[model samples]
Target chain A: MPQLVTVKVNRPDRRPVRVWVPVLPVALVLFPVVVLVVLAAIVACVVFRIGVVRALGAAWRVISALPGARFDIEQGRTAVLVAIR
Target chain B: MTEQRKDILDMLVAGKITAEEAEQLIAALERDQAPATGSLDARPKGKVKYLRVVVDATDNGEPSRVNVRVPLQLLRAGVRLAALVPPQALVKANASLSDSGVPIDLTQLKPEQLEALVEHLDEVTVEVDSPDATVRVFCE
Candidate 1:
């Protein structure tokens, strides 16, 4: 995947910090998984009479907090702060 | 009254207050008005449409601005997809984050607990103000 985000952090009296966050490989790896999981979650929600969006939302919560999972999280607050100013 | 404050009143009378002094009056006439009601928690809740980041600043004496809108659906999809990354990639990301002084262990991120966070974030607005710039991130 190409670099979707190229953070060019310029700080006075120091070399700039260039961080390239790629998006394509991540998308490639997750597309199939998202398709499968979302479909199953939707089906389960329907069977149990649960709202589909709610069920999907619940699943997202679980997945986002999972160990090794924050692939989609915004950048670290501390990191971004340091980079900005 | 200070010249600025008196000018504010004059501007109001002259019908020019609508341009700038309208809001400036609170600062000029009522210094304590803001602190009396400076409560973020008191802000009303609203449906979230997008994750937005806005920056207004100057670089090298030139004005610069950035406005970015991240669809919530993209975040949802990305979180859902993280579950599929191979263990090797997770290790690499974890090491990289730690080495960069971020102190976050991606390997320990749990998806189950992420829902509560995302829900709360839907109501969050982070505003960063500095001498040279103002930045804000919020869901709206």
Candidate 2:
């Protein structure tokens, strides 16, 4: 009974699961957003050209109506000459 | 009247006339409406100065950028279609801009938008002083 021996056993450590993780959904969603931005820019350019041309057409009509303001318009271009007051 | 005399009168009105020339101008006005006849043929088409305006696509490739250099008188007319910021309106619109120099930073105005604002802007006209030709820009 006095000859009994006690032995301590070392246990191997276990790794914990990583709970906080980065997801790529935000980046996945950004691709269409960028595409939409490009499309919007294209649309804006078309609208601007139409507006400018329309504005020029309207201006040409008005200038032609003036008595002394010499003007000409063709192929969407205009020229005007008026003596300074 | 001689072109020289007319120019001199213009200089007088422009406040470039010297004190010594005051007596000469007064005497000339009183002496005769006609100027010395010989100087009439000396004028060269009244100095047809040309102003150039170069327009480029804006960084965003939207309205565009228009750069112009003209006789200050023609600047307003040539860019007549380009909107001018009246000092008061400019001040109001560009309230975020610094009070010194020109009111540029605050407006964020595009060249085409400015052109649209002009009351009666003739299309982009490039007058060639070299050969008296004009190149017009059109929207396609």
Candidate 3:
């Protein structure tokens, strides 16, 4: 069996943020934070659907291209595996 | 037909060699067979423009996945943007996998902020090595 090879091309933007420093007091940073927080929430929700939740989407593409081989996304990277004989 | 010629073309297509190298080779061949032209210095030198990204994965006891290559400029922007985000925000995004070392909720970043970060990216460049073919992001 041909070993599996997974290739992941990082999107121009991939990894998420770690910390959340206000740089200013809550009162001062509230407006920007609110906007950012709202956007972040929307983005986070979309990411689950676009990045994580849609597992079968990538697999379907791989399956259509090569029936004998399988492709899927784990985390966010592309995974390619060979079908058993 | 010659192995040397084949190697040159392969390298050119693979972006391993500059346009000048191919041009030099062609010039050398031409000079070898026929009369030389005007000044060779006048010839255009082609530099490799597009960046390369290579990913190699293996499923052994190690079970390693290596992501090689990132456009230096784009990476710098990513790193800078990564720095702006605090660790708490990452944890909040529920995407922090510290051992993996990549930032959390990155894909969830806002489009405007992301675009702003990348706008200045042209001024910076970086090369990173990662186990999972991800853009580099370090948070303290």
Candidate 4:
């Protein structure tokens, strides 16, 4: 599995937020919050007759496109795993 | 009592129209002419123009200023547009932003969720000043 990376973003007009990416599904230290959120969304899409692999693959592509944002890994993975279960 | 006189009396009793004005109004009414209070146009003007973010800083020894005029409606439109974005796209953006040092969850943006956040911010001014920079946010 790629290490999940967590990203933190602080906005002036909105609440501070975070995102997560599973780095190549191999960078074990990456766990981003948005990754889990997207995971849930992908499942929802699948439930709605969408393709799971296609959705997951698209999500990975998004995570790959981010700029040099900060990321966390270990904690995000636990959260993601818990969310999955 | 005449209808116009009654209105003036009501205003006087409610302390809206002054006593002298009420008397004048009543005298005007006695003359069988209507009086114009002219209160409608007395409303205060100059509503908030923009949500302004002014950034004054010296970057590399050169003074620079950034004025961000974020329309209230743009925030609404942005949040609405987010919903139209597929979750996969958001996930990709999230990854990209995280790598760029922005740790924000793009998937959580919703128009309704921003209502309270924007409400408390309306008309509020936030100022931050450092040795090299000053940042001001307000509804101008």
Candidate 5:
């Protein structure tokens, strides 16, 4: 799981902008809500005849893979970058 | 003087090549020997971690670039998630993909097949270069 995410933007005539977000605290605060969502999801899967274990596993995999991703784009004198760590 | 530089100087002294030509040759050689910028290695040193896509283009004299690095784990996770799709949905997706000229069958995708593909991705690199644009896709 990613603990931090950074975003940067630069424009020709404007001051560059940068932001760093710490994810751990947010994740912690959301833990209870996540648990409830998971429970509801499992129940929904059961009612829908979907495999609960597979659904949970797939969700976990997606979340676990969120770290280490980066995207950067630039045009003319403007640029934007996003990084997960 | 390195051996190659000495050779170039000798050639210049002997008039086999003009001073301007020798200068250009030395400059080219120096550039060839210079340390590369950005990542030092062309290929990842160990297990590949990211799938990278880089694009640089100039249109109407305006330059643009895009760089994306996606974790390989995300690809693995996506493959796993694909398996959970209902067969009916996969069939529809396959038909839609084919209609779009992609010619791929989502129904036939398997985790083992993706693993094999990922293993080979470590050794694969794709590049496209033209006057106005350059693109690269590779795993690193």
Candidate 6:
């Protein structure tokens, strides 16, 4: 799982900007809220006859897969890059 | 021949098993081992961790480039998520896709099948070149 994300942006005649985002602290802060929401969702799924376990598994899979993703776009003198690690 | 096949042939020669039985044994061996041996060439040497797309184009004398690398696990996750969609929603989606000329059935997309597709994706590479642009897509 990635603990950090980096973003860089450059534009014509403008200062290049770069930022680093730490994901662990944010994830920790949201952990309890996520747990609560998940529990509620499970209950709702049970009531609605949905596949709770499968939905939870899928959500976890999506979260675990977010790392190692990168996007870069450059046009003329402008460029933007976002990377997760 | 594999040791198993040789053993089966030996059994046939020693009259321990009938010729038909030996043939059946060999067929079974092949059937059971197809994914393990026969498909080895098709399988990627290393686990594919990412899918990458790159495009370089010149438009009106302005050069532009795009590069994207997506985790392959995200694709697997998305496929798994598809399994959770309601049948009614899938039916509607299928109809919309058909109307859009996709001709695909979301209902028939099994996770296992998608897993196999993902495994084989590493073997696929697509490249396109034109006067103004070059595009490449591959797994790594």
Give lDDT: candidate 1, residue B128: 99
Q: Which regions of candidate 2 deviate over 4 angstroms?
A: A1-54, A57-85, B1-34, B37-49, B52-78, B83-93, B99-140
TM-scores for the candidates:
0.43, 0.20, 0.20, 0.38, 0.70, 0.72
Segments of candidate 6 deviating more than 4 angstroms: A30-48, B1-44
How far residue B16's Cα lies from its native spot in candidate 5, in Å, is 55
Residues B1-140, candidate 6: write the lDDT tens digits.
Answer: 78999999999999999989989999999899988876867754987789999999997799999999999889989888877777878899999999999999888888899888987888889999999999999998
lDDT value for model 6: 0.90
Taking the tens digit of each residue's C-alpha lDDT, what string does model 5 give over A21-51?
A: 8888877889999889989988877776679
After TM-score superposition, the amount by which residue B1's alpha carbon in candidate 5 deviates from its true location, in angstroms, is 40
- When 3 and 4 are scored with lDDT, the better candidate is 4
Q: Candidates' lDDT values, in order?
A: 0.61, 0.42, 0.45, 0.60, 0.88, 0.90
Q: What does candidate 4's lDDT look like per residue over B1-140, in tens digits?
A: 66777889899999998999989888867666423444455656546534667777777776666555655544444444444466777899999999999989888876577755665566488999999988988875
Cα error, residue B7 of model 6, in Å, equals 28
Worst 10 residues of 4 chain A by lDDT: A76-85
Q: Predictions ranked by TM-score, top down?
A: 6, 5, 1, 4, 2, 3
DockQ of predicted model 5: 0.52
Q: How many clashes (backbone atoms < 3 Å, residues ≥3 apart in a chain or on different chains) does model 2 have?
A: 0
Residue pairs in clash, model 2:
none
Off by over 4 Å in 3: A1-85, B1-58, B61-69, B86-140
Which prediction has the highest lDDT against the true structure? 6
Clashes of each: 15, 0, 14, 38, 0, 0
For model 1, residues B1-140, the per-residue Cα lDDT tens digits are 65766777778889975856567665655775455566565676676756778887766666666666665655665665554444567788888988898877776777655645666778789999998888999887
DockQ scores of the candidates: 0.05, 0.01, 0.04, 0.02, 0.52, 0.60
Instruction: Please give, for residues B16-35, the per-residue lDDT of candidate 5 as tens digits.
Output: 99999999999998887775
The residue-level lDDT of candidate 6 at A3 comes to 83
**Where does model 4 sit among the CAPRI classes?**
incorrect
For residues A1-85, could you state the per-residue lDDT of candidate 4 as single tens digits?
2255554544345665665655555433455765787778877876665666655655554443332222222221121111100
lDDT for each residue of candidate 6 in A1-85, tens digit (9 for 90 to 100): 7789999999999999999989989878999997899999898778756788878888889878989999999999999999998
lDDT against true structure, model 3: 0.45
The positional error of residue B38 in candidate 5, measured at the CA in angstroms, is: 33
